[model samples]
Target chain A: TTPLTFREAPEYLTDEKKTPFDAVAKYNNFYEFGTGKGDPAKYAHEMSVDPWSVEVDGECARPGRYALEDLLKPHDYEERIYRLRCVEAWSMVIPWVGVPLATVLSRLEPNSRAKYVYFETLHDPKQMRGQRSLFSTIDWPYREGLRMDEAMNELSFLAIGLYGETLPNQNGAPIRLVVPWKYGFKSIKSIVRIRFLEEQPKTTWELLAPSEYGFYANVNPEVDHPRWSQKRERRLPSGVLRPNWMETRMFNGYKEQVAHLYKGMDLAKFY
Target chain B: MAKVIVFCVALMPLIWLVTDVVLGRIGPDPGQEITERLGIAAFQLLLVTLLITPLKKMTGWPGWLRHRRMLGLFAFFYAVLHVLAFLQLILGWGDLWATFTRRPYIALGAVAFLLMIPLALTSTKAMMKRMGRRWKPVHRLIYLSAIFAWLHFLWQARSDVTEMVVYGLLLLALLFIRAYWFGVSSLVPLRKSRA
Candidate 1:
């Protein structure tokens, strides 16, 4: 494989304080590996990303299985530093290396029938120890979706690497989606398939609880998850004495860029 | 000597946590890590404290009776740290009153800790003497606190409740053993475990 040519990150899109790469890899909610914060780092090494192929199907005009390298071959890779707020009220500003989802969507040539893009993660319990655990309520082969406009947004990213290095197994290598405006869970990890759908797709968290986790799952300070408040987020690399919270912003502070996509729609209802 | 060993064992989680922070190790979200560690330590200690009475009842372990108060107090100590970890690390020591009012789980957790305060104070020989016959009734608040602590844990378990169910089952077994002792077999007017 060719070494990735790193692009200079745009100033406006990145965070100045880079969370240590070790922190990014160690703390995760990837249930395929495990549910604990450290579980993915411990067990995700079993994940096989090299031989990966993504199935792009459904309403797209060009639908077929594309090897990971061939699918991403034509696109330019850019690093984005964006805030990732978990529904659990924790957040991180990650420097992700990948191109916009729009670039991939355009290449696939989605027909007028495509209203949503549904993503699926790897489901093999033999490799993913967490998938084998009957303890998890979430149905396996994690799924997520984005509206057509949201998928095409400038802020929507599909991350392949981090901190100028190929992604670690725990951080969703060799490729994953990174939607900055939505909660981290919406950016599905270790994605294996992408399907264009006419109706809103059933996502993992929403299936677990429709009231608590909606399909949109956008980061909104005002819209409290029925379980807890999303008004404040504890930034990673928290200082020992003073672990202060940063006020969570609507659409994770990408409001100007992506808020128009939800025009005239009740965000709280869609939340 | 065994009490001192138990004290050190009780203190280990906090020691591990402090050292991890000093070594810059407690992972990416230290706040969440510390918060959960302390909360779990407190919850586990509460479970162990509750277990003492049953062990004494079942195995007739004299040592279980001797160390019950210390174990209960240590449980109280961890509860304090658990409460402070939330207020300090997560809340940044801001508006605790708001925390009690706004977040019901925090309030549940707070109530559990509040229940511990009087129990700790009364566990002392002087206070036990001061309260006399009323002391036993007051310390029974442990049962209520344990329920609150478990609920506090279960409420935050948004996605999975496997651990919560385990903890809940443990508490239920403990309570069932007590109820069985008083109501069924041991009607022979046994002496109180705590002298």
Candidate 2:
């Protein structure tokens, strides 16, 4: 098998300069390793991520587990630098390398009954200490879901790697979902399952706090969480003194591709 | 000797926290770091405060009580710095009214800070005497402030809850010891001995 060469494709460029992946990888919101920004980068090395497989089932015509190698072998990897915004008011631009999610889901062959696509992360408590924590409000086997249309969006990527390397465990090593336009949690990490469902599937954060985290966690500056403001987000590698933070943009600046998806509905209510 | 060493060691994190903030290493949101440092300082002070009774009871260390006021005041000192950092960095005076009115988390933090004011003001012996019996009740609010402080930390956290859990356990242990002491004193009678 030939070694796959992934390349970076800039989505949003400001004055002809692409956003750096260092900015994206360094400033992350992965809590499984720890709470701090740097904690994930430090502690995620402990994760054992090889020999991975993803199980596909539910409303799909063919239901079976596929090896990570076999699943990734077909696609030509392209690095698309995307603006990632967290619900907690922070943003980063990541250069992600993967095929479009639609391209991957098309191979699964979803039936007419498939209305939603649910994702699940690996549930090994031995490797993931966060799973063992009793105080965590989130249930084990962190799960996320998307509407079938949302899953098939061109903007969504079935990301296998990031920052010009194979995925780091902290950033969901081996493979993960990257929905750039949505809030950070919507992009589930270390995915092991992709099940097509007839109904709207429950998500991890939404299950933890429904009012705070919605199923459609699109980047809407107008919709604020009960605890904090969404109007601004600290762009990471946060410098000292004034102007460290940036004004948050709607749909994480992917309004061209995604804003139409939420046209008729009220975002504030859904948020 | 061990107690003094432990007390000094606990102060190390506080020292580091301050030095890091001054050196501009705590990132853009120094307020969050300040809050975390103060919370840890407060917890350590509370632990030290609880240790006073145990040391005095078990080892006949009467001098332990002398350190209580200092430890309690240090806790308040860090807490005040935490509140000021939040005001200066996060809530900025221009947005203070909006934050106080709109954001629930800010209100929770503000209430916690407000509760600490009376405790800090009456910490001196002169005010303690002037306030008389009210001092005890006023100081009791520290327990409530600890709860608020924990909640403030818990709510501020994005996803990882491990740090909050550790703090919660420490607070629980200290509260448990106090409850056990009270329960034993109230329920059990002392035996009379003839010389």
Candidate 3:
């Protein structure tokens, strides 16, 4: 399918009324560029993101390397205005355009043993200045994973674009994962690989600091990160003296769609 | 001579902050940006202060000792700005209980600021002389304050921890250098006795 044929469904546009793109772009937590919210917008421009390829491997029947163009060409894009909550106490409403991850994974045809999906980013230190720093705790070629069920969830999107434009390099171009219900980091950026595995796959943040960053990394306000409280978040681009900056909702307000995924399990423990 | 230059250098950020505010370039929330900048500056100055003794021991830079006080006071100055910014911008001096109780990051930041008050107040020649034998022990709280300040920064950064981690590593390196110096010196005395 050509890019012109890609259109957002009416349901997605209705959601956009409640959550705007300005809030989404202004209130972001993209650390790859720098720690500041504005850093992504400024420094992400330095990234050489074209000529990207995503390698699909592990237990999949048709595991092979696919160029970004080929991967994004087949799907009809839809806008999803998701409330993105960071593990830190902050949030934003993002209008992301992409195909459902379930739709993409179904085409890949996972083998019976496939229990989890792993993702990795490009490892070029020259292009990614963050990778050059030895002081950074995050390992180079940042990685993240999700259980097979989580990967197949309708809420999860293999996002290709945002705000009616192609994904900015700072916002994880050419493609990124978007698990709207989970904390922002669970939505890994600049993905170059997808692996289906039998065992629970190791994620980069969890591997770096397991005690601090749990494996699930789901958006459960009750499960406070060891260092800080997750109960509340500061909305970005806050006016000089505006009180009542938007309040954070449970599961980043995707509870209606995804709360059932973790039913019967204790959220505090999984968190 | 170097001490004076170091003191002036440390005040550059504060000067830039005032200029930014005056130029209308401080964005809509000048107060929050100022508070964050000042808090970060205080932590950076504290990290520099913590490095003085280690640098003196390692490189025999006796001049480093003279600059330590100035750097420490700069840390206190920026900390004052940080607290004032929070009060004026975030708290607004109304609803005292709500201001103090609602946000835990504010509390963590306040504790760090409170701890520094004693250190800053006692940083005078008169106070140091009056305290005499107790001065060294009291000044040791600077180390604790630095750790608290680091924790405050870490806690404030919810999702994007890159800045906090950068500052955290700098503090760690400074602390590590001190521990290494102490370990080496203690080992030297034992070696000399054996010899």
Candidate-wise lDDT, in order: 0.83, 0.73, 0.73
In model 3 chain A, the worst 10-residue window by lDDT is: A12-21
Indicate whether candidate 1 or candidate 3 has the larger DockQ: 1
Report the Cα lDDT for residue A138, model 2: 66
Cα lDDT of model 1 by residue, B68-130, tens digit = 788888888888877777778887776566667878888898898998998898798889799
lDDT of 1 by residue, A56-103 (tens): 999988899999988885348887888888888888888888888899
* Strongest candidate by TM-score: 1
TM-score of each: 0.92, 0.86, 0.75
Tens-digit per-residue lDDT, A1-271, candidate 2: 1134775555532332334555455545666765576667777766788788999999988789998886775446887777778887766666677888898898889999999999999887777766666666667688999989989988989887776677767788778999988999999998999999999988988888887899999888888777777888766545433434677888888888987778898888877
- Runs off by more than 4 Å, candidate 2: A1-4, A10-27, A34-38, B1-11, B18-31, B101-103, B129-134, B154-166, B176-195
> In terms of docking quality, how is candidate 3 classified?
incorrect
Report the number of the highest-lDDT candidate.
1
**Residue A139 displacement (Å), model 3:** 3.1
Q: What is the TM-score (0 to 1) of candidate 2? A: 0.86
Per-model chain B TM-scores are: 0.89, 0.74, 0.86
Best by the DockQ measure: 1
- Model 2 CAPRI quality: acceptable
lDDT score, residue B63, model 2? 75
